[model samples]
Target chain A: MMSARICDKIATAIAWLAAIVILGVLASFLLYMLYKGLPVLSWHFITGMPSDIRAGGGVGPELFNSFYILVLSMLFSFPVALGAGIYLAEYAGTGRVTELIRLSTESLATVPSIVLGLFGMIVFINYLGLGISILSGALTLTLLNIPVLVRVTEESFRAVPSYYREASLALGATKWQTIWRVVLPNALPGLITGITLTAGRAMGETAILIFTAGTTVSRQAGDFDLFAAGETLAVHLWYVMGIGLVPDRMEIANGIGALLIITILIFNLAFTIPGRMLQKRMTGTRQ
Target chain B: MSATIIDHHRLKLMYDRYVRYLLFACAFLMTFIILSIVIFVGQQGLVTFTEVSPGDFFFNAKWDPSEGQFGAMSFIAGSLLATLLAVGFGAPLGLTGAVFMAKIAPPWLREIMRPATDLYVAIPSVVYGFIGLTIMVPFIRNYLHGNTGFGLLATSIILAVMILPTIISISEDAIRAVPGSLEEASLALGATRWQTVRRVLLPAAMPGILTAIVLAMARAVGETMAVQMVIGNTPQLAKSLFMPTSTLTSEIVIEMGNTPFGSAWGNSLFLMALVLLLISLLMIVAIRRLGRGSVV
Candidate 1:
């Protein structure tokens, strides 16, 4: 009996130790990145453009490209993703079509970003002859974002009580009217959260962009040419560290990393804060 | 009054039918986009499958894109080898962490750890790649010299860290789903906490645990940025984990540009995509089955 108790104690201790180590690794990785990266971060580093010999370069163009690609992709993906989500949650009958949709969405989610990159290369770059352009990259990212948004939006829609829909219908509102006036407003927060998360994923994405969004850092920011190739912050980070950029490349990479972290943090806050507050308000009112 | 009521009813019926059609169209559009991508990839990849032959692509070691002699065997092997190594090292640690979070940790600790996992997932793959390149590569270079910095070991370690979030989150869900009643029953039989977890709860949650591991494997295998950054991008199969190697995805990235349009190179990219698609399909199936089975 005493031996068994000792064994139990040993196992518990091991479990705790494992948890601590795993968490420690995660925390340490973040801290080390910031530590090695922060010293190089500066205002000039954020706002400046690239110079010769890898010495005096900044990521101004890269930042613009990242934002541009993100906006374009979101613009393309949002309506389709939301439409599909609504169909699945509110309208689809139990049949082959629904099953196929579900299976495809799941498969789409799992198809590695690299494969998407490959597909983009073949269809967008080769077949359509779009070349390596931001349009092609944005289209590929739209494909990537749709599956995630669909799933999240579907979940949010389902979470809404059925009575709300019924109440809207009972008031002589048409089905579309009910959805627009009642269901959509209630699900908007979750939908926004989902969209923001997808945007974050798209922003951090590197593989798909490698093929479609050419690696050239634009010299100017205001160019609205979709056909022109461009690089984003993430890709810039990869190129700088991978292939030796200017002299201040390490600092530039750190600044980019810091920015990437901040962007994602904003995304997470966008997702969770409004969500929790709305839930709290609803529950409080119920009580 | 009767005529007005009849007209309203007719409009309602027509609107319902139209809405149903709209829903069908939207669903069809989603399916069309996914299927079109698959078809496009397969159509383009057919040239490689036909020209290169299965034996050469799967069994040959060399990946000479310049000569149109493309064999992805080494890359495939490297990806699988790295993924296996990652799972070997990461699975136990992740499972233990999950168990601790779900069963052992106090409420406050659980709350903190939960968000930490979220933050881990939210960090972009490129950032992970950057960190690995800056920190892990130098660390490995310092210790192991020529064979260390860029190899399967570095790639595997980075992948292990990258997939940690998946394993922890999924396995935690699995462990938490294990019934308290089962624990009570084991304790009633004089089983200690450890015994209950090891013998009863673990067994019951085996499928969930397996799902978590499989999902982690899927993520590890599919990971590109971090692995690409760390792995030396060498196209060869090596006996030692310390030796440099390339993966299928990394190969696609490296060779996609050099491959001529509508040639075997393009087809090879498609072939790689097909492999990835099949693996992901298997994972989704496994996860769905496990999820359904564990609903109790």
Candidate 2:
């Protein structure tokens, strides 16, 4: 009974306005954090050690730990996740086991990282006596990363055209060769996007490492021992701010926060820009 | 030539078998990890019930660790209250944005907005916590005039921001999933865009949207560092938005380092984490059910 013309106009305008507000909020969160933190962010801040009483604190070890843990976790998880992907996409045609795997993946995805942190604390640290080491943290993170990589790789592999599989098989190439030479290359973009997303997640992760990785920022410089308890930048920020001891805690938190934001931005841009380009070429679709 | 063909076939068979074995091993590992976590957390947490009464742990409002009490009701109340407030405020904004993104935005706007949402997700939760701690908590304290700026209100706002990208993306997908012909049918009958969305698309996407809301709630409840920073980690019932409170996650994180490795406090933290794990899995199952229902 209402006049559709006026109704459409008003609704369209409202939706557009709402879109603008959401966009503004998203943009401002990024811009404000960057603006506030960038002034104090520097190479020294990136590579220096904390003073006893906050005169000149640096996140050198935390930064090193973050990258070190990320690399360690990735190295361990990559094979497992990639192999899971291969199975799910190439071999998991239809069965209860495949369904079970999918369920496990979904369930694992939603398991709170904090809980995973606790699991690492109890199992790896307490029982196995890994003793708050980076290896324990890495193993905990591998549990987080494996499900993500499996799903992404599976999805990417499934996205490849069935005809390509047929063509490769028709040419007498075995299934392994076809998967390696043809399907794997085609699925590279999704795999890359997944890896980047996982990397961002692992770098930004704090709750999982809260107990599993010790919060101590190593004072002894250039020590890259995996067995030692080390804090990543995210955990470092939380610990620094939580302690509330130093006069320059705010400055340290701000610098590290900006760096965290920048790494995330880079990871995101890496995923999207390449993802978009590869997707376009694969689909032969114009933007 | 015959010998070479036989040799190639044998090699191919071995390679195929080896690759499949590796892949299957990887697949099995996924299930193994999930089972291991359940077992480990169960072993750590389930033993504590003998010492701490379930009624005391679950129902008592006070959560003083020094007093030898491990009541988590206050934390539960805080998490639920914060999630309720966050969903209340965040859902409308996210759905509206999703409506615009899916149904109204021009291609250029969609391009810009999509990346913005992605960027929103990529921002670390700790950064959100830092910004909230420095800006939001203080603003509330100064303007609202609280002794401690950190409280449930600030925590809710930070949570709302943290969950926005999830809600928007999920709701957008749900909205876009609506069959175009259905929209056209409504439009041809002279219903406005709003009416089509309200009476047709929204109804159709309700299950998906519900899943999105629940997902956001799950994410909000599990959030640790951000809420811990702003909410002051006070173990009290959430009497008001301005009051400080604790959550299962924040409580564990705070005590994880200080507590002895296998003390009663450590076991209690494990129990708290068990509660979190169960809640998340339940939400995921509910989401799957809703997803399945919509298809039918």
Candidate 3:
């Protein structure tokens, strides 16, 4: 009994030590990056065209490419994902079909973004002749985003109480009406959070874009051309680190690195604050 | 008036059915997308095996594409080693942190830590890669006595951190999911809180914790940019952690741009995807059956 007691105390101490160290590590990593990254940010870094000249490249095109690609992906994926979410949450399923959807989505989720890129290259670039275009990358991204979007939207919609649906239906509303009006209104925050998260992912994604969207920094008038190759901010940062032939590769990395971190941080907070609040409120109200 | 009411009700029911089926079709369409991806990867991946024997593809020492050698033994080993190393660090830290978050932390700390973990999840892999590239790589080279500073060890550390949020978030939920009644029963028998947690809560939560570990492993193995940026992108196997090696993801990235269309090299990369996909598919099924009620 004495030995067991001693073992418990020691285990607890170790757990506490591990917990504190993990937390400290996470904190220091973020703080260190912010410290290292902040000094490199400037207006020119955000808007100036990247230069081929040594030590003079800017991230202006990369940032634009990131947003453009995100928009393109979201444009196509959002509707289908939201539709799937609605079906899962609002409709009582026939079991097998719903099971298949759940199974397929989960499977799709595991198909790595890198593989998705390779697949996109094969199908879109080779077969469809889209080349290394924004459209191809966007299509690949849509696949990556679908699983997460469906899960998020489903969860958010499902969190709305049964009573809300019941009341709406009893008031002479149809099932579709009740879902679209009563359920969707409540799930808007969740939808927003899912979209924001997906957007953040699209911006940060590098591997998928590597093959689907080529890495050339175009100075041509094809900035809006979906057929043109678009290298994203994450990919650009990666390029700078890997094969970027600039004298100031480190400086460019530092600058873009800060913006990428800040952009993601903003997206996270933007969704997470409301997402958490909505989650707490729903669970709280349920209890 | 009653006839009109009947007509209105019928119309509403029709609309409901139409909408429901439409949404179900959308869900069905998602299934189509998954199928197409598998088929696409399958069709392309199969091209490599036409000329290269399965034995040669798996066992050959060299992976030079220009020279037409496409064996992926080292890259496969590299990915496994990377995942193994990351899971080693991530699992312990994550499990302990989850325990602290769920049962030990004060409410105030929980509030802060919860959001911080969310932020961690949202941070880009490239940023991690960048930090690893500029900082960790050099640090290892200077202090850790590496030739070029990039290696398996640095990649593992980044991956460990990257997978940490997944493990902690899911495991914390699992711990919290353990019935409070179990803890109360242990306490009633005069066990300390630590004993209750260790003996009761953890056992009850074991399935969920396993699920978390599996998911984290999947994520770590699939991770690309961060691992690539710092892992030295060497095709051959390294003898030690302080040396450079390639992963499947990194190999695809490094070689794909230079690889021409319809080449044996290009198709072999797809075969790598096929392998990665099949493994994850197996894990996905495991998770679905085990984690039916859990959030991914």
Candidate 4:
């Protein structure tokens, strides 16, 4: 009996140790990124333009392109994903069409980002003749983001209470009216969280953008044309490290990494905060 | 007045049917998009595959894109090697962590740990790539060579770290689903916690663990930027983990622009994507099997 107790104690200790070590590794990576990346971060770095080899450069263009691609992709994907999610959760029967939708969505989620990149190249760059433009990149990201948004939106809508829907109907509201006024409002937090997470993913994506968004760093500050070739923050960091860009250019890459991390951190916070608040509210009401 | 009321009811019925059709059309559009892409990739890629011998494409030592000698053997080997190494390291660690959270940890600790795991999920892939490029790659280089920057070892470690959350989250869910009564019975029989977990809980949760591992494998294979930044981007097969290598995803990214519409290089990109699609399909099938097996 004593031996069994000792063994139990040993296993418990080891389990705790393992969990702490894994968490430590994650924390250390975040700390190290901030440590190495913060020294180069500044307002000048944020807003400045690319400069000579010796002097430091800014990531203004890359920043602009990242936001532009993110906004464009979100604008394209959000409504379509939401519409599909509503169809699956609210309207569709469990038949051949619904089964096909489920299977495709699952497959789409598992399909590699690189495959999406290849598809974008074939269709947008070749067939459509967009030629590595920002518009093409946005379209590629739209495809990539849709599956995730659809799944999340469907789940959130499904979570709404059946009683609420019945009550809205009893009040003489139309089906569409109940969905918009009662169901959507109740599910708004989850929907926002999903969109923010998807947008963050689209912003930081590199490989698909690498193909659809060409590699050239536009030195011309005033040129904001969507059709012109451009770089994003992630790609710039890659080029800097891989090709030994000028000293200032390297600094610019570091600054961009820091900024990207910050943006991701914010999105993560947005994802968790609403869920946490909802949990707390439920507990408080129960008390 | 009676005729007008009947007409209003008929219009309402027509509108309801129209809405249902619109919803079905939206669903159909998604399926069509996915099917068309897969068919297009297979058609273009098969043409290129015919030009090269299957053995050469799968087992060749070099990939010379410039010379029009396209062989994906090295990239395939590198991707598999890195994924295996990552799974070897990550699976045990993640399973143990999940066990701790699901069975051993106090409620407070579990709450804190759960959010932390979710945070790991939210961290973007590019940030992971950046971290790998800046910190992990240099650390590997310094210890392994003191001069060279990045290689397969670095890529594997980064992938392992990036995949930990997926493994832990899924495995924890699986472990939690195991019946508590079994553990209680084991304890009453004077079995050690270690024995109970190893014998009762883990075996019962094996299918879940397998599902988690399969998902992790899918993610590891599909990973691009983090591995790309740290894998040195070489196209040849190497025996050493410290040596440089390329992956299909990175190759597609690198060669996309230069390859013209009808060129073999472009077709090869499609072929690489076809390979990825096949792997993911295999993963889905495996997960489905595991899910069914668990229920039985």
Candidate 5:
């Protein structure tokens, strides 16, 4: 039988191999997506109207609707998530009610996106008579955003050194004043990082939007009507390849795939990196 | 001026008392939403049994909405097979990668891999589907001698790639959470690094690794766009991995739009979604049990 030393060397080599393979896969995937998609991208492609049967089509409306819906969903989810987070971190007692609330959020996070889509369909679209509109889509997407936001908010609030709270209370400050003046300011950096990461994920969400958003953009470019069908870039990527009738659907799909990767990279470099640095700086000084 | 200042102070005091209730309502809204999802999805899914029996819905392989035969067995089986295959391919790679990250790699390499895994998670499902469609499907058809290259094999490979981040990050945390003193003790005992990991670390970290695998499985089962794009989405039980098949998720994505609301066809699709929901919830419960077992 081989000695343990020999086995140890082999396992170490294998672990190195595993790490290399992962990085290699990721590098190739990103490079290939950019290589296939970059040449097709132009100003017109980003802003031009989609053609139904023609060769030349742009994803202007789809891109517009993506941002529009993202902003709306964030608008709806952020406040509630903030409130919930504050409660859990500050006010919650270790009781059955708190446990139930935690369980609900955890289960909500795990619920399949498609199941949430169906629920959105029944309640937001069918029951509420909203039809397949941006409003309905935004409301459904809120459910997807809530759990992540709540978790982030709670973590951020808890990270504020408890002494900060104690010091404020030691003064004549009320509970509300202590939270608003001390805790919220200190937790801002972590909150921003969480929100940025969540927004990045939300921008790429397709399944929930596909059902409620109805896979069709308004005829008018940059339409702001909440009732208009909102087909975001991710959904457009799927729809174009799967069911679109355009002659150049392959090119459109390639462009969309590449565009999405570029956006994700930008989000990471532009927001997440800075956000992380700010968070580190804040904690370093405070702690 | 004195009266106004007193009124402002009183108003602030009242706001503090009421704000707690507001936050409580916001937190309670989550529970309300979960209950609503179960009630709404379950209510519609239950309608499937009104026309078709439970056994027929669960066990029958033949699924034809127009013919009034609503058999969901094929889709159910396809989901299980695909999830199993994905976990088989993904878990070992992820665990080893975690080992490398947690115990093997230097700090610099670990930093790079951290962002790389996040990037993997941030990539959307539809893009994964697109890659599988344009690259893997064609490559499989040509190289593997598969007829279409769009089936369980292709779907599982894509899913394996998609779930790598989830498995790797969780397993790495589990390994890292193993007390540093355990490593010191093993080394002092003259055990090799691999032996220490194999005998001591693996047993200690087993619960966490299992939790990671189960969560990955949940993700694979619920995955829709990626699988639907590559799986060819036929409603049949495939004889081979290369043959076209549909999972509950893929089938719902394909047919939900075409069926009118409240019809047998539409309700059946909701039932498929309900299956996906219950499976994920079950995985969460299993993870909780694993956590409890580890403490003992």
Candidate 6:
């Protein structure tokens, strides 16, 4: 009994230690990556041309492709995911079809991103003859984004108070009208936050883009050619580290890492915080 | 005015009916996509057996593909070992962190840690690999005296960190779901906080924690860029933890670009991906079973 008591104290200390260690690791990792990469970052680095065998090159096209692919993928996925989410939240009944949809969603969510990349390679790149281009990459990324968006949409819609729907229905508004007008507006903050987080994630994604997007950027910065090879920043980072022959690949990798971290921080600051504030105000939750 | 209002109402009804079908189609698309992926990848992957025997593909260790060796046992072993090692290290720590958040942390601390975990998740897997390559690889080489310091140990460490958020968040939810009455009853019976947690709370939450661990394992197994970067990308089976090796993901990423789309080599890569897909799907099914078990 006395030993059990001692064990309790030890376990408590161990739990606290685990928390501190995890926090410490995160802090040190961010700080260390920033410290190493900060010197490499500049307007030139952000917007300059990448060198093949040279020392100083910029990631201009890769940066452009990252955001371009993100936007393209989101545009492709949002409507379908929104519709699915609406169906699940508003229209799904407790039946086999709903169960199957849910099971499919969960299964899709568990499918490896790399496998999705392969499927993209086979279908979009080869069978469809899209080649390894921005279009193919965005299409592949759309598959990756769908499950998450659907889940987020469903969750966000479910979070809307029941009374909103009840009140809209009571006013003789049609189901579609009520959903479009009231529930969606109320769910906007959560949806925005979810979308922003997804964008942040997609921006940093590398594996799916690697096979689908190809590794070479177009010579021109901000090239909007759908068939052009689209190497995003994350892929560039991986490429520079792996098989790159450039003299300053290390410095390039460092800069991209720092840039990605900064983008994530801005996402949290710019969208997530504001969205949370809106949610709190609308929900009337002070705590 | 009354005629226009009636016309508008009729139009709205028609629109509403049409939208329902659209939403249903969208929802059905999930099933369609999943089916397409399995069929496409599976069809491409199944071609390997026409030339190579399943016994060789599954059981053989040698995987040259140039001289026509199709053995993928080493890659499979590497993936499983790396995943198991990662779960071994990560699960306890993650569960502890979950317990800390759900039980011990002050509200202010919990607030900070929650976002911190989110940030951890947001950090790209490649970045984790980069850090492992730049920092961890060298440290292991010098201190542990490994040849390249790129192998199972390094891969496992990075993977453990990568999966921490999944384990922590899910397990935390599970811990929180354990009824408050159970805790109070244990406390009222002269049990300490730790005793109550260990004897009552953890048992009740075991199924959830198990789900979290399996999910973490699934993620660890499928992880590509990170494992590829750190695991040395060599196809040979490692004799020790420090020896260089490769997993299915690393091998596919390394060789996929070079192989012709319909060639035996490319087909083999597709087959490896199929194996990974099957493994993850199996884990999901296992989680579903566990979830059902928890209800009883």
User: Which numbered prediction scores highest in TM-score against the true structure?
Assistant: 6
Shift of residue A174 alpha carbon in model 6, Å? 1.2
- Clash-forming residue pairs, model 5: none
TM-score, cand. 3: 0.95
Q: How accurate is candidate 6 locally (lDDT)?
A: 0.91
Cα-based TM-score, every candidate: 0.92, 0.96, 0.95, 0.91, 0.96, 0.97
For candidate 6, write residues A123-152 as lDDT tens digits.
998899999999999999999899889988
Question: CA shift at A1, candidate 4, in angstroms?
Answer: 2.7
Q: Write the per-residue lDDT of candidate 3 for residues A1-287, one digit (tens) a residue.
A: 78778877887788788777777876776777778778877887778788665676678877888888899888888899899988887774769877788788888887878888888887888899998888888888888888888888898898788999999989989888898889898877667767787677667888888888878756862288888878888888888778878888888887877788788888877655776577567557521
**lDDT score of residue A202 within candidate 4:** 73
Q: Which candidate number has the best lDDT?
A: 6
Once superposed on the true structure, which residue ranges of model 2 sit more than 4 Å away at CA?
A1-3, B145-147, B292-296
Candidate number with greatest DockQ: 3
DockQ for all models, in order? 0.55, 0.62, 0.65, 0.50, 0.60, 0.62
Candidate 6 regions off by >4 Å?
Answer: A1-5, B1-4, B292-296
Per-residue lDDT tens digits for candidate 4, residues B1-296, read 99998887677667767766776676666787789778988888877877777676777866786886888988888888888889988888898999999888998888778767766765667678778777777887877673466777888888888789889988998888898899899889978888999999999999999988988898899888788878888898866878888887767766665788667777777787788888887887788778722110
Between candidates 1 and 4, the lDDT winner: 1
Model 6 / residue B68 / CA error / Å: 0.5
- In TM-score terms, candidate 1 sits at 0.92
On lDDT, the stronger of 4 and 6 is 6
Over A1-287, each residue of candidate 1 has an lDDT whose tens digit, in order, gives 99999999999999999878888987887777677767766767677776647586777777888889999999988877788889989987788778888877877877888888888877888789998988998998888888888888787788778999999999888888888789988887667666676687788888889889978855675467898887888888877777664777777778788888878777766567676567446534310
* Candidate with the larger TM-score of 3 and 4: 3
Model 6 C-alpha RMSD to native? 2.0
Indicate the worst ten consecutive residues by lDDT in candidate 3 chain A. Answer: A278-287
* Per-residue lDDT value at B119 in model 2: 76
In DockQ, how does model 4 score against the reference complex?
Answer: 0.50
- Cα lDDT of candidate 1 equals 0.80
Model 5 residue B134 CA deviation (Å) reads 0.9
Q: Judge candidate 1 at residue B199 and give its lDDT.
A: 95
DockQ score of the complex predicted as candidate 3: 0.65
Tens digits of per-residue lDDT for model 1 on B36-136? 87788777776687789888888998888778777888988988898899998889888888888888999888877876777777788888888888778
